[model samples]
Target: MKTSSFYVAFDEAHKPRGKIAGNYSHLKEFLDSQGFICQPYMEFPITRQNLSPYDILVIPCPDFAKFSTNEIDAIAQWVKEDGGGLLALSHAGGDKGRRSNLSELVEKFGLSFENDQVLDYSKNFGLENLPEVVNFSPPHPITEGITSLCFRAGCSLSTVGLNVVPVAISNEESDPFSTPLIVTAEVQEGRVVAIGSYEMFRNEIPGGFEQPGHQEFCSNIFQWLKTEYREKVKTGEIKPKVTIQEPTQNYDANGITANVGSQPSFISAKLNLSSHIVISDKSDLANLFHGLLDEVTVLKDQIKTVIETIVSSEEQILETQKATESAEAATPLELPPNIEPLPVPEPERLTEMPEKPKSMKDTKKKTDTHLPKTKTHQPQPIPDPLPMTKEEIEVELETLKNKLNSIENLKDLVESKYKNKSYTKAQYEKQIERLSNDLNRSLNRIKELEMQYTKGKK
Candidate 1:
């Protein structure tokens, strides 16, 4: 197979600075390793004829301000007619010298470069408080595997049209209301991926080398370009299969070969059958099956862990409920006894006797009468009803049932779909096991809730 060729057209007048250059150099090495022939535009003339042979073209952060209108138009026409890929990166839009021609190029593809430099103190990257760290949209393949990226100094972009796909986003940290990054139009029937920050490809920024999605973005773009070229080849559309045939020999009853052609036909059939079996073995189907099984095994293990965690939590909740119930039951309730009242007829006589007697025994009796009697019985404080509300219990039960049902359905679906395809059996089993674990966790949760409800009723 012929290797795909790529041409990287960087404007020396507007080329990416410092780390950006270094990063591009690294990208070049990476693509070369993948069997692509990469050539920088700086080493060649930036003309339509010069770029015609390349499968992919990249205009990396070109200082369009230096390019004349005629120069920009030439590049646009080349892409339109030849269907070669184009990547354009720009700085803040107001820099007329650099942005003028580049902006024009992007516009031809239904995209516009915004003239604002985004300042986001909230999402700033470094300790210096510059908003270099930017978040991206999770949906696009270019942004896949990238959660956050740091760009030294980057601009924002805007676009319109179905061909554009927003690869990244600036959160509240950039501008409260601004679309920060975008990819515009399809390339040679494939899409052109554009990013707002030229700094994302620079090396000086911390994590520039290790940033999530950086490598993937570069790789995916080139791969996409290669796919476009491959689709162009008539014979490359599908791979051809090999066939083998066996020859046969036959003889006439007269001991001399009467029909030599008949003998060859008989031998050909047997040989063909043997060759077919040999060719089938070379398909590497076994290796493909093993790889799929391995993936499934890993998935199954993850599911098991999740289930265990859920079960442990459910048990803890059950134990807590039981302890609460025991504590409530152990609390004592006491009722005080009633006392009888003495007769009141001796009130006047008692006053007279107290005045006449000054003896120790009489003094003791008077002190006892003056003291207030203690009451024994007090009603126990009423216990409040169990804490679980009706709505809460019903919701818990419903959730548990739903989780179980989901798991069962998933397991059945996987098993039925993958039964005949055991080479990838692990993948299906892994999904099934994961679903089963989820169901088990739900069942455990349901049990815990039932226990709580029963205790509350008691």
Candidate 2:
């Protein structure tokens, strides 16, 4: 296998800089173990002439506020034409003071870093109560094996005109509009992998924080970058093959027994029952058989544990569903209060009329006879309606209380569902037990089979 080479770039004027400062050291060590030669720019000045020698170029979180447009353009053009892989990391230092030139560099590949920190209480990493959990979307090769990763002081990322693929997402409880934890884009001829935070690869995060396949993730990037180089030297792929041989038949008191040997043997006897036999190299065949048996045993235990965990989870889900249904059923329907009908006035008896009023001309000669004719129909004031009955009010209040209680119950159910414990511990324990038992059983079985085969041969 040909080794891959990577050139890491860092800002010169910045302190606490260089590849070894942050996650770079972790990345370098991981790549080196996979037969990659990582060269840091700080060790040798980064010039256009020197850049052409590297297969991949990595830019760590740098204080790029002082870099001129020409410098950014130079780096961008180099990546676009040479088809070299680029990695851009962001941190608190690069986000503050002046506009980061790193932002301009990433913009060439159609990515941008937002000047805001992503704080997610739900996805936070570690015990410090900071948002650190990153949710991956699906099975992309780059992020296929990573479910969640720990990050410290992460920023946000956004994309522009390029077709960017997001690798990880912040929890919903975090800033919804902020950048994802990781993003990538394929530009003119090169690819760019952008990491929003540098703390993920830090020394304090612990090595085992990532999922089972994260080490492969670290290797894939470098391997992808050096794929062309590796292809030139690769010969042929190696694959394992298996061949089964027929065994000789021998009749014995224990029904019909087949004589299984590494090589075919000549033996004649009447068979009580015909059975297909297999033969192969004793050691190789035994090892393969033992491996399969071990795997099967392990699988059985794993399946059993998984079934139990699924059953428990299903029961919890059912309980939550029932609670939800009850809460919904208990919701009260409100009805408008009953209106009282107005009382009809009783018929009044006609009263005798006195003398008729004098004419307007006769009244006008007397005192102020211009008194306005009284309104023929005067409007009567309506009486205020009585308040609703105490019973009615109590019934309405009780309905409201019931409605509130139902709402509270629904809220409780939701919280409980989210707070429910996961099957992590139980699944892990089962897996460990199953694997251990299978290993032990396989060893014992192999020993017994070897002894039996040896005795039969003699």
Estimate the TM-score for candidate 1: 0.45
lDDT of candidate 2 over 378-416, digit per residue (tens) = 688877544444454445445434434543553444344
Candidate 2 has its poorest 10 consecutive residues by lDDT at 238-247
lDDT of 1 by residue, 1-458 (tens): 43223443334333333111234556655666876655433322356665555556666665323455656666665565555567666654324423345666676665666655555665665532135444555475555565655543456655533345656666533441234465656633434656555545544345344456566766766665443533453134543121111112222221111232122111221111112211124222542343345335433543454465557777888999999999999958654567455567755543334454445545344456877999999999979645766667777587567546655665665666577573166556544554555466567667877888887788
TM-score against truth, every candidate = 0.45, 0.45
Worst 10 residues of 1 by lDDT: 265-274
State the lDDT at 194 in candidate 1. 62
Over 4 Å off, model 2? 1-18, 21-23, 43-46, 97-99, 127-134, 177-179, 206-216, 227-458
Give candidates' CA RMSD values in order.
Answer: 38.3, 40.2
